[model samples]
Target chain A: MTKKNKSALSEHTGISSPEITSSNAIETLKAKRKARIDTNTLVSSILNKNIAALSRAITLVESENHKHLEQANTIIKACLPHANKSIRIGITGVPGVGKSTFIEAFGKHLTSQGKRIAILAIDPTSSITKGSILGDKTRMETLAKDENAFIRPSASGTSLGGVARKTRESIILCEAAGFDVILIETLGVGQSETTVHSMIDFFLLLKLAGAGDELQGIKRGIIEMADAIAINKADGENLKQAKLAKVEFNRALHLYPPKPSQWSPKVMLCSALQNEGIKDIWKLILEYKTKTTENNYFETNRTKQNKFWLIQTIENELKRSFFNKKEIKEALEAQLKLIETNKTTPFAAADYLLSLNKSLQ
Target chain B: MTKKNKSALSEHTGISSPEITSSNAIETLKAKRKARIDTNTLVSSILNKNIAALSRAITLVESENHKHLEQANTIIKACLPHANKSIRIGITGVPGVGKSTFIEAFGKHLTSQGKRIAILAIDPTSSITKGSILGDKTRMETLAKDENAFIRPSASGTSLGGVARKTRESIILCEAAGFDVILIETLGVGQSETTVHSMIDFFLLLKLAGAGDELQGIKRGIIEMADAIAINKADGENLKQAKLAKVEFNRALHLYPPKPSQWSPKVMLCSALQNEGIKDIWKLILEYKTKTTENNYFETNRTKQNKFWLIQTIENELKRSFFNKKEIKEALEAQLKLIETNKTTPFAAADYLLSLNKSLQ
Candidate 1:
């Protein structure tokens, strides 16, 4: 059998089945036919809010096989029309900043308000473990059991770029599956925050009050990218400190030039454990949505982001193809050594290497 | 004459002299031969601290003529062995922050210490005006006349990439001319500050006292890139306010993560008019240099910067070539319209556009 057919068959079986009797082969062929039909049916099922189909479609999008890629593209094409109808929010904080608890509380609040919520994560570190850090259903017990909420862990082990692409595609599947709100979670330590920030309409950074190292929870540029900051765990003894932290963050935000979005970033206090101040944070998101929608920044920003990702993808592909060239790879180390020794300028070396690429001619 | 010869002749004449009789042509040919010999002479003159040779070489590097690029590259190749011997400092501040006066005072101070200083500016705004805002000799009258100081305004307006390339090349020529101190000035209002930051060994931000809008003078990322912050105009009534600002800025810097270079950025107060604290600022730079050099960060940082520029130039060139394709240009607007209307995904559009470029295949 061809490799493609073998992979396609294995895709449905979830295992590589060796050759068997003619009857088993016939059954395998039947399953392959059914999988083809399932692609279209999956779209209709997703549109009707079939959770199982939505999950399977997301799996297909995350698959590395060529056949799965083609199927995923078709699924995405069908889902595209229904996507972008949800409010996507990216939540991030350091590991101990109660991100999961805050998200669980926040997700439950949204569901209680009659909004269907889908929670996703883009954890770069999870790729190495082959299991998502946020995927443990026990961490979000209440939300995990809620019929109105769907929680997904970060896609299993892949490059950040690969993981980011899968999560973004999964967003389309979730939106088409009738989720009205999407919550994207990322660890504050890595570049995942920036990727999550770009894909979401609102970026919410969660910080701990009086950590004494308040800025330590988030990366340097991440604060500047935030649409709003929440000092999480602001209950009990931490109340006064949280309030002061809010004021301090507000002052720091003011020091930054106004965002091009024309809406000033805000600071708020919240306690996920107490389930306090949750509604106020949602209200802030609503107000931001209103202001940005009125100013047309909401749609324009998405369009700009789309274009940015498009060009970025192209650039990445071009660079990959260029560097993957065997000849160029062999020459690069020597050329870099020349640059290090100051025997040749960077521009001159770049010119020489580019001249070596046959495709440029 | 061929275009190459025509341009080569124009390089020496500074104009296109119309065709002449044999006798006049012989004289022109002699001058052209002399110009060919002058290329090597220019290298020797620059190595001998001939200011005129350095100036002319910089102009050649900045020229638009294709012919001059070859000549400039030749001169740069010869100078490579003599470069990388200077301590390059990048200074930036907003328009009303008294950048010119501060630089003038700083330049004079360096010259007084028996240091030959070469000052260059990277003004993005000047590119649109086709004349450099800082190029006026009158702006730094004293420094312009100082025998130990060579002050050149921003190169005639070009794209930021073009201007940055020219300035970087000019640094090589300046260093070859035995200028041990180089100060690169950039207007704080644009992306030019980041460009200047990447190319220099140390970055200094100059501000004013009692400005109320202290952060208003620079972009969000610029402060994080600074090696030290200097509050200028600190003498007179502004002294008290300047000291307060210094403390505030110190607190702010402490909030940032430690730089990879392992040197803590410092904040100081200075007054250009009174020339107070000028020496102290220099001392700070010297201290930073000693610390970084001992840690080997200075050399490593320069090497990293070289590799960065090399890759960046390749990326930019690849993007330029791809986008400049006539067919791609024609299709881009329509594809952008599709994206704006959400009729297609950015990934799908990028794939389609990449396929259109025959070179990719």
Candidate 2:
């Protein structure tokens, strides 16, 4: 038997076949390669300026799968030390405000100055609306083809909180990849701007001339969050109107209480359409960075933001877990019916539901 | 048998005499009475308009003892069927805006119209500040002595949410006790007004003429929540400024979105110190009631408010239970430290703390 050394399959078939040899060990090695310690390898690749690996890591971070989330946590933990070295800027405007044009122009300016820029979006409704599909690249053709620029569309999630979380994680990955400037774009008309504001170093608001948008911004509390207001489209016949808007926004920005940064907000005119006055806006942000950094508000604000996220995450997950249970869903319906029938008070019903959850635990 | 009855106590304690009686049986009867469900009796008494029973029930509601809360729940569950009959009005203003006088004047007006009124304060009291104490009664002396009115000071609690809950339950008790009107008062400078607004049918904000207060109101979003703005201190030389403020506030009110009740908020001038414009305010409220009721918005809004309260109670209790646990507290501190040292992300830290809490269950 030793001399023959026949395989089991060959013996069962009563045939001697040396050509039927198989290497199960080799296949096993190949199979185990991806499953083994991908987190460390991905972090090293991201640090090595490997864009493909960075994109893969972000996909894992955005995945709703349980196992993917665990892997993403490992990668995020490894990347945290290398992260937070870049300047984060948030840009917002309503639809038809030339956000795409402004971002492209702003990004081109930075890249020309030897800066690597990354653009991320926080629109939860992007999947249905003017999403970042292949057609979006056409809107920013020159920037999309630039070697120093990376553009990722908004992550799709059913909830704003969920999407905001993924974008936050993606920022870490992008920063680890050595992006010098990160522009976070969001619509100025909703809560997304507020969420984006909490995560950025400087927030910029863009406005077209005389769109009746200032009142909308004031009513939505967006004006208070803005660190700089740029009256875009300040070229051709729009120049006169844009100048007027700048003075109006200047007056509006002054009414806000002094920022904790101790840096006064400004209103500037620019023409993303003509790529005019774009560098001045960048200079203003750098000035804000210098002022806030000197006053130590820069680091203090980040610390406060981190604390906010920690508490927000725990509270949100607590509610999600409590509400997601099958038992809770069925019992909550019954309790609400009891409430409508006048058989229970809201407080009493709340107590009963909580007690039921406790027992389940 | 008689010898044995006397001997048990004496055998245990040889100093016991005949005069030393033990009421183990009768004391048990007295103790068991409160342990029994007094819900039905309290409900009947409340239905009969017994103010003493209402007061006792409210005391139970305000009590911190676990047993008392349980009894309070029973009483509230019984009162739920008879509650929601009266309109709840929330009155708010700055500390020096003569809120007490306005409430007194407002309370007496209703009582004189043959309406039984109940006034409750929700200031979330502390040791300092101008709290509602004996001086408060002196401030509202006429209304306090009126047979048709009931005035209670703010209930004390460790948290604003706790105080709000107690006051809300007290509102139910008052309504079941045949109160035709319920006034819930809170300070305008803080978060309590928003909490008060959620539970009320109408919201009233009192302002002083030309006190540089409208800007503060707008900043706080109190003006947007108001159903009616009443300018107090409108007598004598202040009358002209009050008229000017009325126009300014009217312009400001028009800028807000249309209210769900289809009611345009009114800006009225009143001198609470002189009891001016009091009758017109009442008539306006009456008109509002009739209009909202005709369009079915009244019932719809109440249903929405009930839903809000139910979800609010559950969410609040869930957070309280999680944070109150000693194990979660220690582990959360460690997790937060990990976040500070960059050993974990906030999202990751939240996950770990939540997992630690899960194992605790």
Candidate 3:
């Protein structure tokens, strides 16, 4: 059997099957044909709200093969009519901000409220080491095992936004499966949180009380983008500081002027470890939803995010394509070599590369 | 007289002549014209290596009047031929890194060796209040008094980068005024260091001996870009800790593979206040010049930097023009309002704005 057909059969069973042995090519070919038909049935099933088929479709979408994106796109398009029903929330915090613990408690809370939750984790590939912890499932074991909860770790990838694109597409799959809430969790390492914020309806930033760095004007810049800021670990002695932080954040939030939505940003203290403020957080999110939906901010924010992604995607593609040409590549290296040797300047080299690429094209 | 001629007369003499009174329309115009002519002559004299003219040209470049950019650009272009001769270095650190003392001692050493020097200070601007310290010249008293040295404090401006761009252009003006070396000092606050690095030939990052946060990868990213990491405040008691910090930095530097130029980044210790190791730092830079010049890295690096600026300029212009359109402005504001009110998603809003702009164009 062909490699494509063999993989097709493996994709049929909702597993990232690592091994494929086609000793009986004829039988394997027949099975592959059956798998292809099954995939179509699975796509339809997902669209019809079949949870198992929805899981299978997401696995297919995460595949690295070119054929998988095509198949995933097809499945997503088929499921589109039934998708987009869920409220997607993105939560980001520094490493020890109780992201997984909070998510588990939050997922359970949503399930108790008759809402099926899907959680997707986004992890960035370290540019130099090319290693990722890929520890999403391990961190949220309870949520992963819960019947009403769906959890997926990030697929190892090149760009943070690349991982986000797949997760975004997978969100459509989950929503089609009748999941009413989707929660995306990302660590505040690097710029991945920005990517996460672009894909979600509301962005929540969790901060530790006293250990916050003063120079990190992140609170100022990010607070403008966020729907809410929660000072985590706010239970015991930290409660006073947390209150102080909330007040400070409220002041900072006020400094931003009234948002265009005419909604004031919310800041609250929480003990994610104690699960004390999780419900209140949820209530605040609901408030955010009701207010934004009533004022049309929810849909407008999502639309703006989509446009941001489209432009970003196009620009990245243009840069990659322009740099990937053979002549341009050779000239760039040659120019860098010259730069290294003190014979030319970086700006001159860049100009040379631009002109070379233009001429080649 | 035209507005150009009035400015010329005002520039040659510090005080405005009574005949150039502000009341008479034509005389006022002539006075403006005289000031302009005086400024132009001053700019020309500065272009021809007059120190005062160079300083005034920089002041004009930093002015709010839109017409100053035209004159500034003209002055910069005229001085371009005399520029690119110096080893432009950017030194940055947080407050209390002994920046003023270091620059004074370093400037003294360079000037003592018969190397004319120019120091441009880029002070941080308060985002909310727009307040700036703007007092580096007073701090570097010795260097300020030295005939061989020129010290200019931060120009009033919009951004750190804005200040840097104007300073970079001013570096050309200073170089034309016969300065052989230009040192730009920036505040070591987050991305500001990186911004300064992007504009210079060599970048130096200064840190204290007892910084606990150094290991959390705060310094690692910038370490890769540094030509040298100098542990300052390395006195008697701080000696051991400084050595330890140097060792730690060396380890971190090792993680970064050799630069494209194949230059091995160096880490050293210094007591800038005590005037220790100042000459060695200059020696290292001299060695860098010798090595890179011999290997052609020096010229190529400058060329590449210019190319980078060109592309950056083009990209900024494209974005500016896109936003400049009246129709695009209306659509964007409308879409942003929708996003705020939840009527549309950010993605959809961006898409709508882009399409509207395209159609309108």
Candidate 4:
């Protein structure tokens, strides 16, 4: 009847597709909505110790989208009260120093003690190598598989400051989700270590004994910042050399004045692959925590770190806003040329540029 | 015209005050006005190699008055084209390291060769100690008396950034005054060394031979930054220890990777008090200048330093403007407390404060 009645111009449907609005599709839609949970539900779920929710929140924090920034801030602010409960440990070393193996073993030791752990990273060079530090989850198979362990790769971006900010926020989320130990791993070769050091309670620098028994790249500033240095691969034939390296580092560590925290940095030997000395390293960290806590350095250091981030965030944003402006970018190059040619002093150029920016504002 | 007549309402003036606009007083006023020269006159007089004008210009550069900032900027910009013609050397040592003796000896050596010299200082701790590095020009008595040398104390300010900026601007004034060599002296024990290092072509660390031979404070980052380490007080009874220190510093210097300058840092034994090895130290600096110039690192490094100052100035000014705001000051304290109580995340608080700043702008 429809074919006959619907002559040339008439339009008619033969049958409505039943599966278009089926119960499974509705349930699937509901699931999709559940998966894309809003900030409040995400916060609640994270507080409820949901790993999926925590992961999603971190992804939101690491996102590059401007729209996600608001949601990320909302989630992070909601989680702030639950944060700052964990001891953030920063572990760093050169690429071949067995960082992954060491971290895996170290993290496993923590989980075995019934401690929930989260590992994050801020590889300053990750923007190029895309995070050689923890880019490969397979590197820490046992740890990643543990229900109590959450491993996050470095936040991929061009600026170390941006990546650092992301990782810092992620630490808050991890702590909010009841992680007792937050391990931040970074490459010791760059500016990231300083950033990692500022955000962490204990900084552990991993080193390897050279063939001549000298430590590699003593990295003066990083070593000065370290709470403890562990000579990795201190097993088998490397034991004697490792001991020598430890002594050398011990002497080098003495070169720095007492830290503001008044805690003397220590040097120890460790074999990550052989799982030797891992316990001793952890014990040293525990000892550090105990002493620093007793002396009130732990809480005071946290307060200092809090204030540092507050100022650092403001300064970074201020510069970012100033430099990201199209007019400022063009004017900056011209001003630099002026400086190079000695036509303008740096301060005068800065003043001129700032005046330009003020107009822009 | 007497007092009785004035009392009677005659309004007669007493005999005119004879000294009121006398030729001698008028000439004195003229001299005072001449001493407080304008920026153009300051620049021209400095370019003419007048020490008095150079000193006045530097004083203007270091002035804390807001109005002086503009005048100082004008003088610096005018002097800039005449700058970059001299080698800027930074000399630093701990308080007890015989810094004054070494600098005086080194400076005398330069002046003896008919090379005019200018010494500036940036003691970061100066605001408290009022510049212990070069606070008293009497410390460099002979050099200060030398016709070919000029010495200025550290610019006094609470912020190292402010002091650094003032010293940096004064470098232009000194260079314009036809100084053949500029020596920037800073205390090695604090952050001033880094500030001085960033502003100079050559960084010389003055070390002392200790009671034993072990190098004092091996000073990792500074040692890495040094172009040469001169073990001062290396004569008489300390010669053997100084020899040992030289060897030790030489070994320690090798621990650092090659610098971008491509010139290896050297360690030498010197006795400034005895005037021993002063010529050799000067020769070493000449060699460094020659090598770096040939490699183009000299020019490129200056270019990099120029850019660093440009960005650093803008960033510093941005923070200064923001934090100095009355609203920002109050909001910052409130935000800090909120952060302490975990009522807000740093980045979120940063956004809120930044937005607050934006609205004011």
Candidate 5:
């Protein structure tokens, strides 16, 4: 099919548009002719560190089309052996915490050290915005212009799970494309922070100084997930308050039960705007990486995260299938009504609903 | 069938022996004839505050026997209208934190105020020990002897879900049995704290004075869930440290995001041994109850909890059914092996496995 006709077919069939392939496939022949270009072409290109091919492969991974799924799977499987070679770091902070500026500074520092960086995001709210908050490249102008830096915004308009799964797959493609550092950014609100935390080697929480409101909007659980917290915008007059906030955060952290990682979470001060303390932040991350790697927590955590994602994927798929059943959907509404009225206990209602589905037997 | 014959039949069928009704049914008539006595009898007896009947009803709720499930469901449904009339409190602490002593004192105080208190525990670890820590009533000598108090140990040897479901049902029965206060105790070690925290109207965390180890073994998440924290052993030489600890705890708690309950979590010093601050703790609970009730948080929270449990029960049942599938089980084992060997991505393996299951289709 012509590229135009292929996309028309895709649209008709509800497949997401294959952005890069369209141009070339249009200049090519029929549908059967396209099969001649195997997933190996994509795999070889990604392995050769071709950015366009890497981006296209990520698009395939993110596509909801069942048609592209098999090809995406093939490409990801081929890339797997080359993955896990990079350091995956998760960065999160509330809006207005200068996350983009911090990333630009951090990315520049790493690239100066001859490190290739790939930045991905897991923004649950992107669905509402219809585009990621970081979709605008101007936010991180310096890093966006750097050849060694690859900055991809959050995949918009998808469930957190969907976004997380795609981003995780994209990380593999990025690593296979020869990136040495993966920076996964997430908005501090909602469950995205936890999602990002699970997939990364090190988790950094960015906070503002002089905001007793610091812990106000962020969950204590999220704070506890941090491997280190950096008090952002620590330049000029904010310096003193940032140091004090650092002390307070350190004290608060001490009151927590030690993490299973056996590495104590550290608190630091940084000024992304002034490009101050950026190197120290990177140093802290390197220190953590070295310590956890020595204790084997770094590798073990990745393995555990793999197992966790496996179970999580199974559960999500199971829930989707069960809830998608026409009978279950109807029965669940009735059972929820019964529960809301307090006429039946939740356990009994669950039993009744399960009984309605013979497939469960 | 005769009582002896019925029990023999039960043994043959691998059914658990009916502890309370066997003899009466044996003296009366056949197995089917005894079931005709109805769950109403259990409900009415519980409504009249018959302690023995209440205990038997709880046992029915706790039973793993599929035969007793319907009866338990019916009894719980009958008791639903009378439930939620009492304050349900969850108490947790590490083993040496004097939880039982504190509870005994707390129970005595409530009864002294003309309140009838029922203490129930959900200890998942009790099964491993083969005896509940609270199973020894001699530990709470004063409360055990108090006529207005009813103390029951954890139901041993069941999954956390099973135990939590039973204890939740027991709370309904206790409230229907005219108990104005329901105290749910759980060891601070595991997921039981989160379970207990969910069912109760208020959660109280017990701590020790001089132990910087206060937060050592307990999860910070659990601490965040607390409505109040009481530093125990606040007597004699420990008084100064207790006061200091209380202040420190207060400051630590202040750093936490405000709870949805809008009641700031209070930290106080209490000597369960000396009975100091016991009344004040009760007053704190009363104040919390008043504030939350005034804001309608009490009712809204209960509703939210009901919905939460409803969804949790459904998810648990769905997982149980899915994992219990023979084909899925075998496939999962194979897939996990592939995962461990890094042959397939977890998402791909999950997709392949889900495709293998007809039910998922």
Candidate 6:
């Protein structure tokens, strides 16, 4: 404890103090436990308006590290009471549809009206490189810098299609942190749009107006899931084409039955670059909410969506586990070979493989 | 001494030879073991100019007794070498499309051509009533008595949509038995049509012309899968409309990509009831086969189909076993509760439940 003793200890240990290694080890242990505790506490604190804690909690939830998941779950649970306040809107379109630019314009317009906004970019498309995320933020500089607007570029290292569960859970955390409106931006990976739609209150599909031939490749089921179709970049020379495309979409919409929510999806045109029709888009969403809520479709839809997620998640997990089984690994290979050779019917082979798994159990 | 003993035994048993209970028990045991051996042999023997075995095998395959499936498999395997020679065709349409009557007409035509034929009715709509199968055969009495033709009704105690797997396997058996063509008749359930399509070399979708509203509910995907769309009941007053529908289908076929085999799926008009266009209808299926086989599409498709069954079978088994777990029972219940309460994301709850499954060794 004396100065002379401390110097001797530092010199002998080569660590400035003999207790440094042990203390550092202790500190590391404490930090991990603290992180775990903080996740849940941060969730609660952020629910009470603590921004720093909320950021940490969302980070934990999005992490791929196995240890982080439980802490993330606890945090999500703590934040649950304060969540579900905001209107969660999911926006998706093909790669070149100017989604970030539209979000920037859309967010600014909302903030101008004194509305607080949270932009949660759930990019399930490609990996989020540092350069790309920065580029995305740079494009939305105006909205990014606004005090009333919170823009979070998607967190890194998760499944493509934007770590569906994390993005969904993060929405709750963001809403609990008091952002009145939540915007979820999804990439136009054919299937990710469906995942995003399942989580959000409103799903808006953006399209680039073009010939009908181009529309054939996109899956019809996805087009039917959209609550509203906005033909982006609708100004300038493309204006007439955009209008025609809108008409086409409206005709297509007629072929589909009304959604279970009883919402008659709308098709509109907008030039996100010129910030044209941004206000009308917002107004339409509000009207949708009002109509659906009046009909009690909003609450019912959200509940049904929740149930769908649960079943989907369980089914996916079951599939993953079955494929992962060691015994099943060999049995499947053999069964597949037999199947390829046409020695057995698929149902019979399936029964045989399944019986093997059951026996093991 | 042997004659005296035989007389005493017969007298004591109160029978011409053996005791009735002992005789019945031996017969049951023998039947069970035979059933376990594979039913194909019986089908092959019966179909390959052996009427007795074919009838016996069909009965065995249709038996509700657990031992029959084994016998069926055995008989079928024995019959396999004879199966691949026939052209398999699937026929399906809504009720009153005159399915039974059409088959009668078609069967008679084939028999007249000196071509042996076999028909298996797969009717999910009609339960296995005491007379339903026999009734279909009775309706086609003239065809049924033809030495060159065979007609089997839908089996009871199996999933609807057609003759069960054993029945399909039996088709191959019948073909090997020297039947040049096999026709699968399915009840007009729209969805079930897809199941039948996967197994057949050519799929014939029978539709009543001008059934517009009903057609809308029938998915376009299924229509796209059809190799030939036949506007059936095209005789008399319906003839003109049937032709128009056939033309419309031809146009629709143009929209789909050239099938992978480069086979141009044909659309045609026919009246199974009036026997109108029956010969042309068979000609179309034959032409399709010839064209596809010339391009090697026919063999390639069969291989692909076999592979599909293998993977599909394994996947189903995995699903069944995973869901059957005791832990999943609790996990599912818990997740359902969370889903109901909106406490967890469906994806997250699914991941958690799946993680609880015994880790693959």
Evaluate model 1: give its lDDT: 0.85
Top-DockQ candidate index: 2
Count of clashing pairs, candidate 1: 1
**Native contacts, share recovered per candidate:** 0.68, 0.71, 0.18, 0.73, 0.63, 0.63
Task: State the lDDT at B127 in candidate 3.
Answer: 29
The lowest-lDDT stretch of 10 consecutive residues in candidate 6 chain B is B213-222
TM-score of each prediction: 0.86, 0.90, 0.58, 0.87, 0.84, 0.80
Q: For model 6, how does the per-residue alpha-carbon lDDT over A1-361 read when each residue is reduced to its tens digit?
A: 4466755436444445446557778998998888867775786688776767777778878887777777877777777777887888988777788888899899999999988888876654354443323236788889889977887776664454337767777888888889889998866665667777788889888888884443342333567778888899999999999999999888878877878778888998998899998899999999988988899888777878777767666665656656678998898888767756656665566667777766876
**B1-361 in candidate 6: lDDT tens per residue?**
3356765446444436646578778898887665554354555456557866776777776776766666666666556545667888888776677777778888889889899998876654464443444345677878888998888776664354224555666675577668888898876664556667777788877778888633342343566667877778888988888888878778767877777867677777777776788899888888888988998888778767666655555555556556777778777888878867877666667677676765532
- Listed in order, the DockQ scores are 0.47, 0.60, 0.11, 0.54, 0.43, 0.45
Model 2: per-residue Cα lDDT over B206-259, one tens digit each: 988778766557756788899999998989999999999899889989888899
Provide the TM-score of chain A alone for each candidate, in the order shown.
0.86, 0.90, 0.83, 0.87, 0.87, 0.83
Displacement of the residue B128 alpha carbon in candidate 6, Å:
9.5
CA-only RMSD, every prediction: 8.1, 5.5, 13.9, 6.5, 8.7, 5.6
Q: Candidate 3: where are CA atoms >4 Å away? A: A1-173, A180-361, B1-44, B123-136, B215-220, B323-333
DockQ of 6: 0.45
In Å, residue A166's CA in model 1 sits off its true spot by: 2.1
Model 2: per-residue lDDT, tens digit, A257-328? 898889888999998989999999999999998888899998888777777788888888888888999999
Candidate lDDT scores, in order, read 0.85, 0.85, 0.72, 0.85, 0.85, 0.73
In the range B40-110, model 3's lDDT, one tens digit per residue, is 78766975667788788888777768677656666665566666788899897777878788888899999
Q: Mind giving the per-residue lDDT tens digits that candidate 3 earns over A166-231? A: 787788789878888998877667677778877898888887777654224342246566788888
Top-scoring candidate (TM-score)? 2
Q: Kindly list the per-residue Cα lDDT of model 1 for residues A1-361, writing each as its tens digit.
A: 4466755436454566765768778998898888779988999999999988998999998888888877888888899999999999999888799988998899999999999999998986765664686768899999999999998878875567678778888998999999999999988887788788779999999899877654443234777889999999899998998899999899878767789789899998999999998999999999999999999999998999888878877777778778888888877888899999988988898888888875444
